[model samples]
Target chain A: MIISAALLGVIAVILAWPFPLVLARSDWPARSPDVALVLWQTIALSGGMSMIGSLLLYGLVPFGNALPQSVIFLGDSLRSGTLPADTRFTHVLALGAAILLSTHLLLNLFATFVRAERQRRRHYTLIALLSDPLNGQPGMRVIDHPAPVAYCLPGAGHSATVLSKGLLRLLDADQVRAVIAHERAHLVQQHHLVLLAFKSWHSALPWFPIANRAENAVALLVEMIADDRARRDVDDRTLATAIALVGLGQQPEVLAAASDGESDEPWISSPERALVAPRVYRLMNQALPLSRLATMAVFVTAIALALAPAIVLLRA
Target chain B: MLRMANLGVLERLLMDVLWDSPTPLSANDLKDSLMRPGLATKPTKPLATTTVLTVLSRLETKGFVTRDRSVRPHTYTAVMTRATHTAELMHEVLGQVPDRQAALVRFIGGVTPQEADTLRQLLGVATTDNL
Candidate 1:
């Protein structure tokens, strides 16, 4: 009974925590659209998967004595006649329902991993092209492709950042440098690993709000970090020009390169213009304000606090 | 002159050698110069002329050093000053990140205090007087 209670409690918290976190954290500043999208996707996928898993597990607890301990417990209760036969039937039915739900959830997670792996491999080729020392300066190689595109691949020795030939022709040398610098920052920060973690979490528990929010926040923060690096190394005007130029072009199908897709309608429909405005504003606003820094500190602390209960429970 | 943003660490080292040298260096000359004398260095392999040619070609493409085909043995000359190239590379690196403050905070948090201090100095930030 104690074990069952503990397990149920743990599962309940896992299912419930992510949602509030996501809601609270969304309002905080983010780095880029790429990170935000990935985060939301991960959370949605993970929470949905877990919910399905739970339902499946509930459905599979009937028919034969498949679950040995549960059956034995039922049998002992039956011999004693302490509980009615109808009650036992109801208990078994409930268990079966849970099993069925859990199975579906686990299967969904498995499918997501397979899909992500496929996507990662496809993007890796572009990353390899960028990292290749053919021309030097571990920069991207923009292949001549018609549609605007960008993609990244994490490599063993060095990563690559591949861009489309169209993008290269679109911007001047200074802008191009800014773009390369941005990609390099991603590599240095190992942002891909963070995305991978959040993605897996999302797959495992598709209904969790916190998972979605955390993933989104991290993604945005990393992009912001990379952008900051670009600001310091390159002239703000040049970097802004690069962002404007790249953002103006249609986003490529490839996910490795940074792009502002054409159909990038902001999340809010009524104030849709704010999305494009923020991108432009961010580019124009080069100065780092103290208020922003304070806000970030508060945000980080909140995340840590939100994650604390789970950490404690796990440790206990 | 090669853009610092485009050069790899090894390529940079090789360029440094050529930049400091008074005369043009053949492939053999470069290989000999690269053989570190005092340190526990790896056994030097005889570098092929093709390898040197490839590196030179890459350097040329990045616009760091220019080739002077005027002589019988093609010679290379530095197009940009070393200081300018370093500055450019630094600029390129920083330009890639979207949020410099957040990235700096994360980066500094990840490193040792001493290393963080060094980075702060490198970035020309005002440092505290404490050790």
Candidate 2:
């Protein structure tokens, strides 16, 4: 029990701090966002598992040799008037906190899912009313808006890529095609689900730095991944140009803060702007893919991180 | 599935029928109108009244049509002129630009200084003609 408790502390500290910092600073992810996304998922899942496992362990410290025994000990203690002799006030607090925290995270995750789904359904209904099949484009919907917008409402068979009439008028043929390709990539790859998971985690633990950073990083990374896919058929310059045009019309206030790179302003402005710079730079410079070995190494590390807590718990 | 497009086939047919009528329509009236030759885009087979009822309810939900249950036979009427609905749909989508957090993400790409100037030039009042 002592050994497990010590190991949980070490794991918790790493997940809460250094791991997120190191991952944030790592530039290799830009080279392969897809592989990096996998790593991110592993980290998020394992990190969550470890968080819950650590709390469970802490709650069980005075009770028994392992989780099941500790749970039985807790039940017995509950029936009797007194807890185990070694069970201090802190243990009771830890036990209560562990239950509360686990429940909170689970409930938040469920709520986020329901919220996102409701929003998506509403969007779908509105699009059905407002959009028309693009003249010759089968899967596309032409909205009559004039803000140069383009996006895909992600779903299984129901997914539809939408473009504003203003967007059609603003860009040349190739640029328009690039916008289509980009949105198509989002639908084809189902990036929404990836984003949804990260979003739910962020909602669940908004105060946690690791969750906050993970959500931001994953959001940007998914865009890059979609950009990479669109780049397959479209030239980088056209796509970048399309991006610029569309991005310019977004929140002017947010963009103003973003353009002033030296501003000591709070990061309350949309992180999307910071993300845009690297994406444009990547498109312009054309970053090459990392070697196969390095990619494999990242994936291996991710798997190991995910499995580490489980192995520890089993051993205990 | 409920279709929502530029006056979806059913919506357009229903709208046209509603507009031409002097009073509100029952689902049977809509079905009869829809089944008339040369009235609908696809009038090949007559539609089920239930299908017509479902479409009317969807139209009501979308704020395109209104239901009146005060009478024995529940009747429906167009909530707005077709032009008005079209204009409103455009306006709603335009309103979505500032709130991209909901429906669309990544509609914008990185903008260079030159592109920003061009976009600024195009930022005049976006009328139907612009679309």
Candidate 3:
């Protein structure tokens, strides 16, 4: 029915809005040649899979039965001489569908907004506690908390960086600064917003393949971006050494700590941290060269791909 | 330095509401004002007073606003003026750019000719007055 289609269209549009914004704003490292190829292929595969699934489910299913039922309902209404057969039933169905989809989208948006608000509150509280102008650095506050934990809360202007007392005592000043710079970079580049938006997308549509892949890719890319920024402020050797030292310390509860042992799953651990430990272990760490041309090419390609669908839709 | 990255769109809108107001307003006042605008026709779910209070408290903790508890109902004021906050944001963003002039040029390139002329005229006055 027109109503149902309209409802679904609105929901889809609402869910898709965040994706474009995130792609535009993300400051992730340029996709390597291999990564770019993989991402493109993955997107194509997922889009194809979804297209096939939708066709099978919507096209091949009990679509004919529904048509008769709709016709019967229309006849019954027409027989009563109360409403037009054609428009009445169709409008009802459409309105019903629109209401259902709108409710679903609204609920999801509310939940995301609430979660984001809570995170903001926590971030602000941490900022208030760790704010020390005397330190004279644009980074997170390393508080003297009993437990070892690492997390970031985003802010508007100068976002607060927070670390526990355990972390401060565990690492030297340079090591601490390295960690701060890394976290600061995350804030500076607005990476958490990407994570938050992706999380909302996944929650809204758990079956979407692209959502999961995008989430994983974004997590890894953000860490790499932060590492790149941190390296600019600190020597590569110093950063590598700091990452190794932090990894070795191995706090049980801290999820953000850059250590394989800290996480139960080796695959999910921070890739930047993993790269650092091996190089620092052998004392052969060097600055990772960034290819500006490659970065620009990937950025342009992503923009083009993201726009292509919209352009087609608009033209249609 | 608080990063705006963490704040939700609603929170940002709420802050803007407060920032735009000429006088300190209570939570009820803000909720009422925001609702009065009728921006969206979708049935308005009235936000709870507690939610507004929580947002204000959070903003206070973030140093974006200050709360005056001396009155019967607490009133909040923005800690930094709009101009100062905007300037600080501009400074931070410009500092982050790899080439500040290039970034500025790109940004200015996007401005309308009339706007660019106005900016040029303003800059000329400031330059002459050394303000």
Best by lDDT: 2
Real contacts retained, model 2 = 0.25
lDDT of each: 0.47, 0.71, 0.48
Alpha-carbon lDDT of model 1: 0.47
Higher TM-score: candidate 1 or 2?
2
Runs in model 2 lying further than 4 Å from the true structure: A79-82, A135-138, A251-273, B1-40, B46-51, B61-64, B68-105, B109-131
lDDT of 3 by residue, A105-160 (tens): 55875777666666465545434433332265554454433323344556565466
Question: Rank order by TM-score, top first?
Answer: 2, 3, 1
Q: How close is candidate 3 to the true structure, as a TM-score?
A: 0.45
Error of 1 at A14 (Å): 11
* Ranking of candidates on DockQ, top first: 2, 1, 3
Query: What ranges in model 1 sit over 4 Å off?
Result: A1-27, A31-114, A122-134, A146-148, A197-221, A251-277, A286-316, B1-131
Candidate 2 chain A weakest ten by summed lDDT: A262-271
Q: Choose the strongest candidate by DockQ.
A: 2
- lDDT for position A191 in model 2: 81
Q: How displaced is residue A278 in candidate 1, in Å? A: 3.4
Q: Write the per-residue lDDT of candidate 3 for residues B1-113, one digit (tens) a residue.
A: 22344234345546667777899888888777767765432114677777677777877776778888898688887776644453332222222222221111100011223
lDDT for residue B87 in candidate 1, whole number 0-100: 31
